[model samples]
Target chain A: GPKVLQIPSHQIIDMGQMVTLNCDPVSNHLYFYWYKQILGQQMEFLVNFYNGKVMEKSKLFKDQFSVERPDGSYFTLKIQPTALEDSAVYFCASSWGGASAETLYFGSGTRLTVL
Target chain B: QQQVRQSPQSLTVWEGETAILNCSYENSAFDYFPWYQQFPGEGPALLIAIRSVSDKKEDGRFTIFFNKREKKLSLHITDSQPGDSATYFCAASGQGTGSKLSFGKGAKLTVSP
Candidate 1:
């Protein structure tokens, strides 16, 4: 099974501080994604990246959120001046292709808490 | 608007009994459906999936019955075991949506031994 690794399983940050979540996707994966899940809600798609560009993003992906995979290194999600509503578990996933039929491998998830 | 919906938010079944979870989608473009299973403190993993073209798919103790015309599907887990207790999420992706899956709230299953 392919593995996607997420750093900092749990993160606690002040409401106005910046935070970055890192992901190490499968070595051969081409498409990367980030999803957010509240304590009792369904996992919602935030954004998807491919070839250095954002392919698609949902409304949940706020203006303060950004993603990048610089120089084939770790895929990172950065949130500037976090808000209390940003508190949730973030899961990173990757797939070998951009097709709907392609299987996605997800990381354990990083639980973010804003105080 | 939740594009994908799952029913019976929670279910309990005796060991060796069959557990059925149902799902339906509103989007007509959705062609791929994948069911994921998650244990507490862990990420969801793909259990079994079925394409719109197929009416049924089976993998060992798990089977997916799909009704393409009805835009609905169901997962049946037979011979349930305590280890199978977990949350099951039904996800969908359309042709143009690629792998950006829309997930359901999930159905929590408990297997009583």
Candidate 2:
């Protein structure tokens, strides 16, 4: 099965500090996505990127958040000046295409705790 | 607003019994529905899926019964086992919506063997 690998299974950062979460998506995957999940809550979509550009973003994608996959490298999500409410598990997922039926391969997720 | 909704926040079923999980969606544009299974400390994985065109889809012990008219669906796990214990999330997407999936607050299932 295809695998999406997330770096640093857990991260503890102080509020107002910047944090970067890294993801190594499936090699052949072209579309990348980041989702946030709080305990016992739904997985909320943050943003989706394709062709080096952001395709769509949800309200949860705050202005402080940014995503980039520099030169075909690891897709990264960087959050500046993190807030306490930003504490959640962030899962990275990738798909070969953006079609409705395309399957998404997700990483185990990075548990970010903003203290 | 939640585009997808699921019932029974938590359920416990005994082994060999059938467990049914219900889901509904608010968007009429959604045509693709997928069920994802997640265990503790792990990301959700695609367990089974069905399209709006199909009324039923079966895969081994797992089955999906869809009602396009009512905008509802259900996943039935027969002959459940302890390993089947996990949180199941119902997700929806549509052609015009690209691949962004709207997921429901998952239903946690506990299978007692």
Q: Considering just chain B, what TM-score does every model have?
A: 0.98, 0.98
Model 1 B-chain TM: 0.98
lDDT of 1 by residue, B1-113 (tens): 98999999999999999999999999999999999999998889999999999999999999999999899999999999999999999999978665599999999999999
Q: Write the per-residue lDDT of candidate 2 for residues B1-89, one digit (tens) a residue.
A: 98999999999999999999999999999999999999999999999999999999999999999999999999999999999999999
Stretches off by above 4 angstroms in model 2 are none
True contacts kept of each: 0.71, 0.64
CA lDDT of each prediction against the hidden true structure: 0.94, 0.94
Q: For each candidate, report its DockQ versus the true two-chain complex.
A: 0.74, 0.74
**Clashing pairs counted in every model:** 0, 0
Worst 10 residues of 2 chain B by lDDT: B93-102
Cα interface RMSD of each candidate: 1.4, 1.2
Q: At residue B52, what lDDT does model 2 achieve?
A: 91
Q: Which residue pairs collide, candidate 1?
A: none
